[model samples]
Target: MAPKVTVLDYGAGNVRSAVRALEHVGAEVKLSRDPQDIREADGLLVPGVGAYAAVMDALKASGSLRHLGYRIAGGRATMGICVGHQVFFEAGVEHGVRTEGLGEWPGVVERLPAPVVPHMGWNTVQAPEGSRLFEGIEDERFYFVHSYGVLEWNFDVTQPAMRPPLVTWAEHGAPFIAAVENGSLSATQFHPEKSGDAGAALLKNWMGTF
Candidate 1:
């Protein structure tokens, strides 16, 4: 059977596009609002499109905050998109207010240093060697429409005892973390669903992981 992927619809993302993308990649997609679906999902895709504080607030209101964290920590094959990827950090600063995130990894989301406020449109990414997310589409540009992003990868992934994440980067005014793959947790700063062929290839790569 195909992997049953659930797209968390906590009232923050363009869920329909993500669902359509996932389905196009040959995975069985489910739109979910219940925390129970998150717990039982073969794979989870948390999609978001908005400010960090607001999205975090919506996730909290939806009551899947704890469950989402639990699944990622327990290695439940979770993937986050756009602002969904932003919430993987420890916190995010939007309009001078810092909001706590799911903290799937140690980092912070802040405004990009680009001259343009929002880094909108297609851009190529610098994927690490052996990237499972970028896979065959490493060189292709993906769609991005965001003003905030994670600027660095803090932990030492080179340690033999640790499994380092595959960190991908892209630059507007400066380089920023565009994507990450660590164990069962994976994410993208760009909207792969909105991206064209490159996006579809990336989604297929994610489904193949499960």
Candidate 2:
């Protein structure tokens, strides 16, 4: 059977393209706000658009936030896209307002240091060696449209038995996280849904992990 994936629909918009893209890659997609479905799907995709604080509020209002936390903490397969990716961090500071995030990792999503706001367009990412997300398309460019990002990475697994996250980088006046492959969780600053063939391959790669 095709991998069963649930795309969290907390009214953040821009989710239809993601749903279409996932289906194009053979995923059985379900767009839902149901918490049980969120926790039990073979893979869970959190797709977000718009401001950081607004996205968080929507997730909370729909009661999907707690279940999202549960799924991630339980080490089930989960992927975040765009603002969905941003909320994985501890906090996000947009328009001088600081909002708490899912805290899946330690870092703050801040405005890019570049003179250009949004940093919209296609760009290549420096995928780390052994990165499964960019496996076959390591040299290809992906779509990106956002102004805020995690400029620095501080999450390091100190335990000798644990593996650290494989981080990818892209620049817009300065370097920022492009994608991350950390255990059961994976995220990309770029939108694979809008990334064309390369994005489909990337999504297919993630599905292969399940």
Candidate 3:
């Protein structure tokens, strides 16, 4: 059976493309904001496109915040994209406005220190060793459209027996997180749904983890 993946529909933007992308990757996709679906699916995809504060408001307004926390705390498989990926951090500061995020990791989302603001278009990422998501597409470029990002990563597993998260990096004017694979949680700063063939292969690789 295909992996049951639920796409969180918290009114971020047009998520039909993400739905189509997941389906193309052989996932049994379901579009919903239901807490039950969020918890029970084999994988949950949190997708977003827009400002950081607005995305958090939508997630809170729809009562997805707690359930998402619950899902992640339980170590279930979850993936975030774009602003969805941004909200995994402790906070995001956009245009002088500071908004709290899910705090899944210790970091702050700030404006990219780049001559070009949005960091739009195709760019290659330096995937860490042992990354399952970039298995076949390690050298390929993926689509990105964002201004704010976690410029630094400070989260660490203090225990000697635990493995550190695999972080992928890409640069505009300075290096920023491109993607992260931390145990049951994974996320990307780019839109796999819009990345054409390379993106499809990435989605396929993620589904393999399910």
RMSD list, candidates in order: 1.5, 1.0, 1.1
Angstrom error at residue 115, model 1: 1.2
In angstroms, what RMSD does candidate 3 have relative to the true structure?
Answer: 1.1
lDDT at position 189, candidate 3: 98
By lDDT, the better pick of 1 and 3 is: 3
Candidate 1 residue runs with Cα over 4 Å from true position: 157-160
Q: Please provide, for model 2 over 80-158, each residue's C-alpha lDDT reduced to its tens digit, 9 standing for 90 to 100.
A: 9999999998999988999999887788999999988889999999999999999989999999999999998987678
Kindly give the number of clashing pairs for every candidate.
Answer: 0, 0, 0
Candidate 1: Cα lDDT at 85: 94
lDDT of 3 by residue, 1-210 (tens): 999999999897879999999999899999999999999999999999899999999999999989998999899999999999999989999999999998877789999999888989999999988999999899999999999899899877786977788999999988999999989999999999999999999998888887
Prediction 2 global C-alpha lDDT: 0.93
Runs in model 3 lying further than 4 Å from the true structure: 157-161
Give TM per candidate. 0.95, 0.97, 0.96
Give the lDDT of residue 96 in candidate 3: 97
Order the candidate numbers by lDDT, best to worst: 2, 3, 1
